[model samples]
Target chain A: MKRGVFKRSLDSLESIFLFTSEFVRENHVDPSLLPAIDLIVEELFTNMVEHSSASTADVPMEMSTVDGGVEVTLTDEDADPFDITKVPEVDVERAVEELDPGGLGLHLVRKFADSVEYHYQFSNRQARIVFRKTAGSGGDDV
Target chain B: MFDLERREAGEVVLKGRFDAAQREKAQALFDEIHESVTLDCSELDYISSAGLGVLLKTQKRLLAEGGRLKLIGVNSHLRDVFKYSGFDRIFEIEPG
Candidate 1:
């Protein structure tokens, strides 16, 4: 497959994760791992949808499901230079402590993914996160 | 939005996603239950760290009111979230 392509407004984050989750479950990625995957995808997708700049804001998120695992690559040509890796650690106690309602998405991605890579080249930003079903190969089974 | 209802037996069952979008309402709805409440998590499809925070907050709120909170129909996914966050031990969980 050429991988699934998702292109929509910033408001589509919830549906994006919901749709991707079905694809993950269909791939036999393990029913046990769905929550972690779901959370990570929700967090990541929400970030890409909401945080990206308005100029190239119409960017599309591409997802590929291969033999080994699922790979989500969020691509935005006109997005700002900030890296999703910058999403800080949250004190879970104060996750919503009126402090701020942002940055938790990247934390979820790191916490759940086996490997998270952010590649910014030629003013094009792509955050590719890979989650492996089998543990110890660099990813947690969760 | 989740539609909530009360019982004469002093129990409350929440039906729907207990996620970020619903946490605020869930809290307000939870506050009205003046007695022990058992949340039916079967209809709850997903929850996030924010939602989990709401649960913890509710637990503290209920305990302070001399009331208890229990969760029912917790699937593996939700259970994982609870376990990962250590809320599994915090909530009075009952298997479906």
Candidate 2:
């Protein structure tokens, strides 16, 4: 299995796509997993930029092949020690008129990825999120 | 970056990435509305939660005002995104 790592500057939201797509292309990730991987990467990177207190940190991203699929690890050094997997699920059952859009990102991320893990290094104030997506996997819950 | 192209009436073509950075620009499209609107997303490559949020807001507004939101030309990748997010049931998505 090949391991690829890179640091992305959050200066522009464009880097999120550029970095992720470039990584996917370089690593020859499965085409079937592109959407899930793309969504997972986008949500995590955007959340870091919008919510994290860090103004200028090169977010670390790691990608590797696993037994059933691919694993993505995103490290935010300046972000608060929070577990994304613990975020409350969106009320998808709510009527379209009553639906709330604010909390769907993490929920969708969790649903799209097969397994999600969180790690925080208190000493360095870093939070690392590991998302695994099996090939041909479908979303678990809305 | 995202591109908005107007086709006929009540239809807007979407291209490129629709994400947080493009939300404001995308939301501005909702300022003027008629009885209905359709977004042609054949060229759209990606959408994030922020982009989806804009659609939700617009859809609610349109429905409240007796208008409808129809999505056309959704590629399979985006369709999966909508389906996994459970948006397939919320909106009328037409395949390309």
lDDT (0 to 1) per candidate = 0.59, 0.76
iRMSD value for model 1: 4.9
Per-residue CA lDDT of candidate 2, range B16-89, in tens?
98877788887896655556878899899888788889888888888888988889998777887787566888
Clashing residue pairs, backbone N/CA/C < 3 A, model 2:
none
Model 2 DockQ class: medium
**TM-score of every model versus the real structure:** 0.67, 0.87
Tens digit of per-residue lDDT, candidate 1, span B1-96: 355666447555656555555556777876676667787777676777656666666677677778777899876567756655546556778755
Maximum-TM-score candidate? 2
| Model 1 Cα shift for residue B43 (angstroms) | 3.2
Ten-residue segment with the worst summed lDDT in candidate 2 chain B? B29-38
**Candidate 2 per-residue lDDT over residues A6-89, each given as its tens digit:** 344333557656655666677677666766677788788778877885546777677787765688888887667778877877
Q: Which ten residues in a row have the lowest lDDT in candidate 2 chain A?
A: A1-10
Candidate 1 regions exceeding 4 Å error are A1-14, A25-33, A48-56, A76-108, A121-142, B1-8, B21-28, B64-68
Model 1 per-residue lDDT tens digits across residues A1-142: 2244555353454566666677766766644555666676666655555566464444455555655566666565565666666666765454322323245445555656766777666535443444333333222332
